[model samples]
Target: MLDTFQVAKARHTLGLRQAGEAFKHVISESDFNEAYNEIRTWSGYAPTPLLQLPALAQSTNVEKIFYKHEGSRFGLGSFKALGGAYAAANVIREKISTRVGHDISISKITSPEYADLAAKITLVTATDGNHGRSVAWGARRLGSPCRIYIHAEVSSSRAQAMRDLGAEVIRVMGDYDASVAATRREAQAYGWTIVSDTSWTGYIDIPRQVMAGYGVMAREICETMKTPPSHVFLQGGVGGLAAAVAAYFRQAWRDASPHVVVVEPELAPCLFESAENGKATQTKIVTETLMAGLSCGEPSQLAWHILAEEASDFLTIPESLVGPAVRLMARPLAGDTAIEAGESGIAGLAGFVTSALQAKLREKIQITEASRILLIGSEGITDPEIYTNILDEN
Candidate 1:
């Protein structure tokens, strides 16, 4: 598929010295490992696989391509499952300490002894889809009540999943960024604890935990990937997942951090715009796009702190490329198993392939035949109807 969106690009760090300093100041391996250890105790905790796509590599003219398939990151069907739930758990732990007048062990938060304490707290958030489900799932796991606010454009399938998980759902009037605002207002009014993955001023810790939870996925990628990739392309929403991936890789690879490229919807390229402006910037107009998760109109402060300095490139892609990317992942050219990736799930691959195909883009992003590419397959078919429609379209 031909890409209609022009890539907005930048190289933040002058060298490994600057990149390592930026990454160290933001997050560390211990931050991610704490979450990973806690996540290991979850009922369905299992490492998501890092699958090699040689045919994809050959097609893109790269030496190798490794896709960390996160479709089955727990049964929630997206990497968001790792984040919101873990943050909810952490929030509950803090509440538990407040209730008991002392620090409590992390494992005992969900214990039968503290079940009533956990139930006393209510967690809330706004989402396009995956994050809300993960928050609801987290609340469900800790026996806490959850409520989610979503914008008008959110698909019914995603809303229904949240409802199915026993979360109260509210529909707002605008787009995802609007729903986040709505969630903030409603949270303040009701005194509900907002366990969001995105961060703002005076609201960094919970999101820090949330991103740290996502770090588990990054840690797994590093531990499993034998040959470190030359480039790590990640899809950006509020930048939580992308930053987590970038941070871990930056730490693990040390002075040899991969060329990190952040991808987002052209209609909602807040990160791309932020990188270009050299500061966090909000989108003037929020618009519809096929990649719901990437349809945010603002950048997260927490994410910006990590991404602005560490990320080497940023790309905003058109909706037209999404359908073909999904189709490409669904049918592998070689004997590799077909990946059941959704529209948002394939954004990294979409951006990577788009850049690799064009000589200018390849040169601009510093891609060549010797480069080893890594694209995260972020979600599975979370929305069956949209998945089927797009899959059938292309």
Candidate 2:
């Protein structure tokens, strides 16, 4: 099966430091517990599957392969179901509590008692797709008005999905970074609370909450696994998902945690650029890739702080392998479960496969037959039209 695909090259950078106490303030056990406790109480909350791919492992020459499939996550088809919605809930809860002159329980924040207050608080964010849908769904659930901003390349289906969830969808003229800026400006002008997954200077709190929400997924993975994996290849989109999962593994397993490898599309590799420059650097997205959700130009500052300290490696995959990765997952090797993964979801898988096939990159990242690997399947068929097109291609 491995012989069917060509060995794709990847650019890798070793991490700055081992996971430690430094970035705990950004995301901690307490934060994860809080998010888990609240998020688990949601109407449709459940841990997504952790799939074992012995066929993939055998093909890649690894001891084992575990994929945390987020396709069924809250029926949203992406791992982003955790982050944005939970952050939106927090925003609504906090604002309502401030108005009521006392702290309100997250449990009761969505009760009938807070309906009017929630209605007054409009939640806003800019997303490539998944995050905006989560925020919009949360806003609708909590009785808050929501506004979602999308970039020029964001699909009509994704924008309409947010609209279906009651978000007022706005299409910005430029790329994802421009949409993010548009959200900032509009939020300030209209006094809307921004529930962004990515963080900037003064915007750490909500993003922190978002990442903590993501910890529920990590916790679920740990709870389900008999043993921790040796390596985890996480997809990087503003580094929130990678940082959250990496941070959780580091905290949970400490010194024995899996080596974190952040994977991004070569076209929009902000975290890769940041690793190269030794800082939270921004890349200008001159062209977008098929992996739409990972098309982020700027790294989240808070996420970078954690990724810098916790992640062991960073890799950028060329656009050529993304479709193949998706197709492979959908039509897997013998005995492997068929996973309907989206382009963004396949970044980690693409990185892992490429690294496994390329000897130099494999050794550099320390992949061997004895190594157990974990990959986060971050999304599913997020956009049906785009997904169909990819599958239909030769």
Q: Best by TM-score, which number? A: 2
- Candidate RMSDs in Å, in order, are 2.8, 1.3
User: Scored by Cα lDDT, where does model 2 land?
Assistant: 0.90
Worst 10 residues of 1 by lDDT: 8-17
- TM-scores across all candidates? 0.94, 0.98
lDDT of 1 by residue, 1-394 (tens): 2333234232221111133355666666677888988998888899998888887788778999888888898898899999998999889889999999999967777689998888889999999989999999889877899999999999999999999999999999988878889999989998899988789999999998888898888888878877688999999888888888888888888767788888887888888888877788898545688898888888889888888778888887777788877887787677566899988888888888888877777897899999999889999989999989887884
Per-residue lDDT over 18-68 for candidate 2, one digit per residue giving the tens place of the 0 to 100 score: 445645677978999999999999989989999999998998899999998
Task: Look at candidate 1 and tell me the lDDT of residue 306.
Answer: 86
Clashing pairs in 2: none
Cα RMSD, model 1: 2.8
